[model samples]
Target chain A: MLKIDELEKCYRNKEKRSIFHTTKSKEEKKALDGINIDLKEGQALACIGENGAGKSTLIKCALGILSPTSGSVRLFGEDPRRNKKYCMQKVGVVFGQKTNLWIDIPVIESYKAVKQIYKVDNDTFKRNYEMVMELLELKDIIDVPARRLSLGQRMRADIGLVLLHGPELLFMDEPTLGLDINVKYTIRKFLRQLNQQEKTSIFLTSHDLDDIDEICDDAIVISKGKQIYSGKLDELKNVYADKHIIKISGMKTGNILSLFPGVELTEKENQSIISWDKSCYSVQDVISGVFRMYAVDDIEVREPDIDEVVSRIFTEGVSI
Target chain B: MKNFWTYLKISIKSKLYYRTSFILNMISPIIVLCGQVLLWKGIFKLNNASDFADMSRNAMFSYILIAFVLNNSLNWSTENSLSKDIRNGTVVSKMIRPTTFLSQNIADMFGGVLIQGLFYTLLVIVIFFIAAKDLFVPSFSNLLLFVLSAILGMILRLMINDFFSLLCFFVTGYLGIAWLKNAITNFFSGAMIPITLFPVTLKSIAGYLPFKYMIQVPISFFLGEYTFADGIKTYTVQILWILFFIILHCLIYRKIRINLVIAGG
Candidate 1:
């Protein structure tokens, strides 16, 4: 439901002259360079990038919060800036660092305010509000002021506040930022369920890989404001996930290293870990080979984590 | 309208959230009013027959009290909160809404003025009523004009404040701007001293500028100092200035969208 073509954004920086400065100098910095992207209807797209990678810049330009220095963004086949009111009606946005709810009001009061502001009819409002509160587990804390809520509680409330309007598309910037594992898991599962049941298109940008695995089907990797990889998440994983982890107990690192000519082995208390390219040998073959060579113990074979794959892609480039 | 009311309710609820702080805020304005009362009464007594102007002592007191209330409303601090919204990216919340910047600001002003400023003004008014039974109660016609002028004055203040709030995007100087506005309005809107008290050139400058209409003219109309013709002329000028700032707010907002629009910055 969103399209960006050759998007380029340049920010002008004025020199921070001295305390008694005389002249004004300007420098142009490129925040986004030649970005082209399209997100189809009902697809949850993950924007993978480190900080300052222009993910926010791209989203802001699409949402019409920021005017692009060049190129165009079309949402639902119309310019977001031109049809902002109509577009915003169907769009829900959340910034992890900020809240849309009133600072000192009960969570439910904020929900009621959302219902009023969106002009939702009473029946629909009741149904949606109850559903959101139940799904987000907001009932017990609904009467508590937002200022008193924990970060996780507040993020859930913020999500529910936006979802009360039943938006067709949701944009979340770092939605799981600085959150603990339990809260992050709750949000990830909630988002996945919402996307599945409602067919809601989601645009999510986060550094967390588990969130990506749980909620998103499509992936776009951005590095230095340039599109590096834009395709299926599994394909990105398969290409970069070539190594497998093997942990063996009752084995010495010296014996394992001698068996394999050029393998990196790490040893812990009673176990040795060996990492090797899957392309070089199959897991079954390695298991049999290790069993034939080594005596008694336990062995575990694990696939490389998605985070490791992504980190490799980021550091090693898209050369695989 | 429903959205604005909801926002207004929520805003007032926010102010009322800290009950003790809310009560504490009511004291400062009353204290300031008492000081202004002492200072103005002493000046009148020191002037003896009031040789400086044709205004009377009762009229001067009424002007001061009414202008005190009006100035309090005019200089309400929506811009300070707006600057925070911009800095912290909470402005994106407003952007995601169906409303414009002006609507959001108007809702905020209603919250700040009708609660934060009105409480103190009402307390001081009660003190005034107990102290002076024979003092000014505006006539029906003056009351009608006063209400209209005050409404427009509020809109004008919001527009001016929103305009400068937009400057926060470029300058990042909210405190300086706020103090400058406070100083200028105090000097020009005549909360501390009426424009009649100013020398000839300063009075002429006040006449051309819009700050007097915000506080001084409203008081003049309330005090029955302005004739019907004079009131209508001044109201028309105030309306024109309101329209000017409304357009100016839109222009400045466009500039902000072009140059600012911070998200996760």
Candidate 2:
């Protein structure tokens, strides 16, 4: 479990004074401002933000890698700044851009080193090592040096290394960034299964919306160092995803727009795509009306995905 | 202790991973050692004497050989490596683990130097056996003292290097700091020239500094130049200096953690 209350972090500018400008600048830039998050046991929380939105900063502050300027952060009911070793013993962190594995050594060697570093006993090390190896599918690359592996392979090895100690919580920053679609899905599935079966709490920050959709249930949206939205992921989708798209392909669909009062339609060839706000028009009524009045060969309905909902929130400044 | 050994093992494995580089590094030191020996021999030849500064020709050669081996043993690029880690934000990996940063760096230094140290030490023994069997062989007690002092010296060197390495957090580059550290340490520690050959004033000043203990004093113990009383006095100073740097590192690191700006995500 983790608790962060009104956490704020500010970085001072390191501007050199010129001969013409003798006075030093004392300006401080806030990377995180009055942000709060409480992640319960076994809860997977997604920190959604764009580049430079202070999402990484928040994770660093919570991990005691960077001290907060103000407010407090507690990991397992202890201040991480003062008790980093104690908190870190139960925590696993994976920085997607950076590697935790020793680059020149085989991935298996790094895993063995982790076992000694964390003082994991033989039995537990064996069990966790086997589980991580199987789940991360590290059989082929385990003996290769980390520097020789691809980004996806290295990331998988890193994740496996951290889990060898059986950490109670895992903090991942863009775990699937820059990976192929298959690799991304593999990582996401591995993480989801870990959360579901092992009950390891996950605090994930990623630009990839699908990672969030697959791995996290609760979500907090950060923009400009501010917590703009915090609630259930489903609720966030429902709130900003108010519009639905209905695509119907037929020969004569030019007059479909005239039948619906507030629907927008675009026709290309034999396909007519109808879009409308669900709050204004009942989907069932509209579908029945179009079915009765128009000749339709094929029809399909689509709801807004998390990616579209998040884009809308950012562009429209939707907050709750 | 477990973490320390784990780090040491991993560091050794990494250093040995690149065979060409490791072999090259091992051979480079021998070339430097031979070059230094020839240079010193030429200096003695030019002086037209079998002794300089109360050291006979054989004693001076032995001193050079031992110093070369000891200096190579203590050499660690902690500052450069740490500065790189800090600049690139890879230092976070070390910080997040449940191990002390100082111990980890110390292990890495030892791991890196272990192979070279052993090789050079064996080379020295072989050279002494073939060239000068009776050249400055210390008594058993003195050899024990020398071994203890040398271990402490290695630790002292690591502590000093780490102290300078931590300054990378505040600076953009480490070149200047490293140059300054090397110049000061080499001059005062007698790694460049034995403090015994210095002018009276310079030698006295070196006597008061911690750098002398890092190289000259330990060599003194190995050469049987230090009495029991002298060994005790030198050790007291070495321990105090080690403690000083350790405390300073702890204080500075505490401040650094608060202001640490990891360069990249």
Candidate 3:
């Protein structure tokens, strides 16, 4: 539903040579370095990157909030900048720290205002408003002034407002950041349900790795404004999931590192662990070997969580 | 039109959310009006020329009252809102909305004027009518002229304010500049004193500036200083200035939009 080509956003920093003299200087900070990506209809793409990696800049360009210094962004078949109204009608964006609802106004009033801005018909407005309020559990807080609501409540209200108009494309930046665990789970569940029911195309950014794992079907990892990896979530897990740690509480340490030529041993006070790098041996073969060499009491091997995988990618700075 | 009603409702709800603020807000304008009345009354007594240009103490008070109302009605601080939106990055989402920013701001202004300006105007009119009954009462025709001129003047002021506010898209830290513009407009627009009280040369110069239309022209119409022909000429000039500023505002906004794209704001 969205396509970008060679998008680069650059800012010129003007410096004064001297206060009295008439000389000027300049430097450029290129926030995004020629990023290109496409999102298929109904696909949830999570943009993973560090701060200042140009993720926000890239989103702004796609939403036509900021014009790219170079390159083009197209929503559907048309340029977003040129057909801004049509593009706006097809997109719903939630800024991490900013709520579009007027602060001192009641939540319902803000929704009414959004309805007018989107020009929704009466029946659709009524039906969607009820559905959104019910889905977000905002019916009770709908009459409360937005300023009086908690951040989590406000976030839900803001999301409800975005869904009121039923935009096909949704942009959620750090939606779960700073939110409590319960709120995060509620938002994640609602997002999954919305995507399933409406077939909405979601572009989400989150510092919470669990959020990405729960809802994202596809992922793109960018670092320092460069796209390092783009593929299905499972594919990333397979390609990068080389090692599986079998945590065994055995009171024995027979140079566990010597089990395999390349195995890394991690020993605790009463436990010894070894990582079976898939590059060296299959899980079944490693298990069989461990059974033969040492008494295996209990063992459980599983894929590393997204947090570990992402931390590795960042710390290792691997190039995909 | 639906958005207009919705915005008005939201604005009202927003303003009423803080009862203390609403009460304090109502008191502020009255205090300002009293200050002006005292300052101008002192000047008129000292000059001992209350009847100059057919302007008595009562006429002067009436003119000041209307001028105060008109000034508040025309008060549109573009710099404040623009700078805030920029700092918060909320302007990004605002731009993505299908509504025009100018229209939204103008609608906001109407809401403000209705809630704050109308409250002050009504309160002052009631207080002045009782306490300063001798102040030259407005004729129906003068009232009509005053209303039209004030509306046009507000439109012109909004255009000018919007133009200056758009400068934030390029210039950094313009809070002081916006305040300076407001101060200049307040002084020269006749919110402080009638332009007629100024020296002839200054009054003639102020006559041409859009600032004068915002207060002086509207006040003069209410004070019955101008005949129908003179009122027409004065208002026609003011309307032309309003049209010019509106066009200028749109042109500059378009240019600054392009500049924003280039500068990556």
Please report the candidate that would top DockQ against the real structure.
Answer: 2
- Winner by lDDT: 2
DockQ order of candidates, top first: 2, 1, 3
Weakest lDDT window of 10 consecutive positions for candidate 1 chain A: A251-260
Q: What TM-score against the true chain A does chain A of each candidate get?
A: 0.86, 0.90, 0.86
Instruction: Name the 10 consecutive residues with the lowest summed lDDT in model 2 chain B.
Output: B73-82
For residues B83-141, what per-residue lDDT tens digits would candidate 3 score against the true structure?
56665556665676776666666666566667777776887689666976658887899
lDDT tens digits, residue span B1-265, model 2: 8788899899889888998977776777679878988898898889998888788877777778888887776444433677677778888898889888888877877887686778888988898888865476778998899989988887898888888888988987778888898899989988888899999999888877788878888888988898888988878889999999999999998888677777785
Encode model 2's per-residue lDDT on A121-165: one tens digit a residue: 999999999998888899999999999999989999999999999
Higher-lDDT candidate of 1 and 2: 2
How many angstroms is residue B126 displaced in model 3 relative to the true structure, after the best TM-score fit?
2.4
Off by over 4 Å in 2: A18-24, A247-254, A267-272, A293-301, A313-320, B74-79, B200-205
**In model 1, which regions exceed 4 Å deviation?**
A20-24, A246-260, A265-273, A282-301, A316-320, B74-79, B116-137, B261-264
lDDT of 3 by residue, A1-320 (tens): 89988888776767767678986677787878868889988999999887777777777778776667888889877887678778888889887677777877888888888888898889888887888877789978999988899999989998898888888999988887678898889899989988888799899988788899888989988888878888887677667766777776655635455666788777787566778667787778767766766666777775666787788888898766
CAPRI verdict (incorrect, acceptable, medium, high) for model 3: medium
Residues B69-110 of candidate 1: C-alpha lDDT, one tens digit per residue: 776653343447886676666777887787766888778767
DockQ of 2: 0.77
| Candidate 2 residue B118 C-alpha distance from true site, Å | 1.7
The best-first sequence of candidates by TM-score reads 2, 1, 3
